[model samples]
Target: MRKTSLDVTAARVSPALPRRIPRLPGRFPRRLPVRQVLCLLPLALVAVVAVQHWTVLTEGFGKLGTGEWPWLLAAATTTCLAWVAAAVTRQGAVVERMPVFRLLATQFAAGAANHLLPTGLGASAVNLRFMTVCGIPLARSSAALALYILAEAISRVTLLIALLLAFPSALRLSTLLPEGAVGPLLLAVAVATVVAAAVLLLVRRLRTAAVSFLRTALGEARSVHTRPARALALWGGSLAFPALQAAGLVAVGQALGLQIPAAHMAVAYLAATVAVALVPTPGGLGSVEAALIVTLVAAGGDAAVATAVVLTYRIITVWLPLLPGALTLGVLVRLKVI
Candidate 1:
């Protein structure tokens, strides 16, 4: 109640003084949040897969050594470029511009996830999470994912059609698909259509959700298309992804002495990938190998050599990148970048 000049000064300075933090006497610093650690789950899973496939990786690399080094190098380069394409496509999916390095890193990490989970579920999940972490709402993020998927699929099919038109005699159905495959494929498509219709008719909640999602996704797509730069990035990246992938396969074919023309190999690759698109395997695994080999053979490649080429190509494009990609994913998760 009767404070002097000294007391007033001390009281004023006390409020501004920093509180001392307790120092733990140990080399270890702080504990990480459990939620953040959970984000690193993919890294562990990828590591496990790597361990299980160690022999395959070694053999694939050894096979690469016997091929034309220049072509192999080209294949590797194309594989790397494919990641860049994926990053670009992801950016095109959303209106907001993401950090360049983190976007690139996420795409790289998503590569590992692609192999771990069936189809593209893993990569898609990683991207959705990344978008949410970057402050994008769940619904918008989902719509962006849909837009990316649609654009990529459209671009891939369009490229295939263009290639087929440009090179009339390059790919033949008899060479690639089994005679009865068309009938079964048609039946499967019909079944899928019917099932989708039935689901929409019977499941009221699902139907409402589907309609709402479609509206949101379409709106987002339209917004994205309105921006010329975004549209360009979306379509450009989409086209480049498939093109680079085919280029990698072609390079591998040349390296392994496959007697297919470059254009033919690209056509075969695109066709095979499209055919195997519906397969539920993780990264298309056995399905991809079978399709690629059969298609390559139809393109006039020796079956034995084509097998080697496909194997080498997958190793270079998928397996080799998994570890480093996983590492990048872990780093990003740890730093809360995603």
Candidate 2:
């Protein structure tokens, strides 16, 4: 039999695409120039502010050096536990099972990216890339990240509500304003609304989406309705992550010899965290510091003590992670992993 040209062409076509175009692995999409520049602005501002406030930061570090060793150690321990909690949440969401050690490494790398990248694209990029490495499709990874963000928002709001209920006076205490009579109250309401909306949307998405779709796109959602107990367990683990983070902040205050109570610390931390999260700043650098110090003072701390404690907390939580994150980025590049 004579071979037809159409028959030869049909055999050459790939399963991955419609026609016989050569299949090349795709590259990550380039960020738009305008967005990239906007992201860099916050990082730039962070550098400028840190440089301008070097003297104060130096003093804060000096105070940190004088902090009680046990308390400082405890702060680190609690923060480590927070990371463990985060990893547990992530593990429950992922599709394929990987070694725990590898997952932890990716988690560290993601944390580093969130701290070091100008726009924290590091976390998003790292998470997506890591998911790709685990054989998940891009859309599914994206959905997983969206779910993670929703989980975080819910947990943070829960903590915020707990703090507000415990310390009603904190409503009048934020240093985060033009000193308007109702500015803090308005901000609180705004934050609360955002948190509620985020949680509701996530819950609804998981509930309404078909099981097959959620299984592939956001696998954790499959359990959300069918297996409520597992879903709650995952949510509980995620909540523990941020709760431990707040605990770390409280320990930092105690470590610095600040006579702040844990309740006051929680309220101040929640308020400052919410305010700083609002800022466009990467990692909420200077904005976080400013909000934290002011909120701490409003929560009845001395200005100097509040400043010192928040500064130390940032050092441990922010700067300390940057070096490792930078190094991890380098390692990833060398491995051609990202």
The C-alpha TM-scores of every prediction are: 0.87, 0.70
Where in model 1 is the C-alpha error above 4 Å? Answer: 1-40, 51-55
Q: Model 1 residue 310 lDDT?
A: 85
CA RMSD for every model?
5.3, 9.8
Compose the digit string of candidate 2's lDDT tens values, residues 1-338.
98899988876784546556555666555556653454344345446656766775687678779888898888878877876777777765654554576667667767766754544465778777777877878767777777776777788888898878867776455354556758677898899999976776778765565445556655556644356554654687778877888888899999887777788788788777766665565666677788888888877788888888888887777666655655655565445455
What residue pairs are clashing in model 1?
Answer: none
Q: What is residue 335's positional error in candidate 2, in angstroms?
A: 3.5
Clashes of each: 0, 0
Tell me how many residue pairs clash in candidate 2.
0
Clash count for candidate 1 is 0
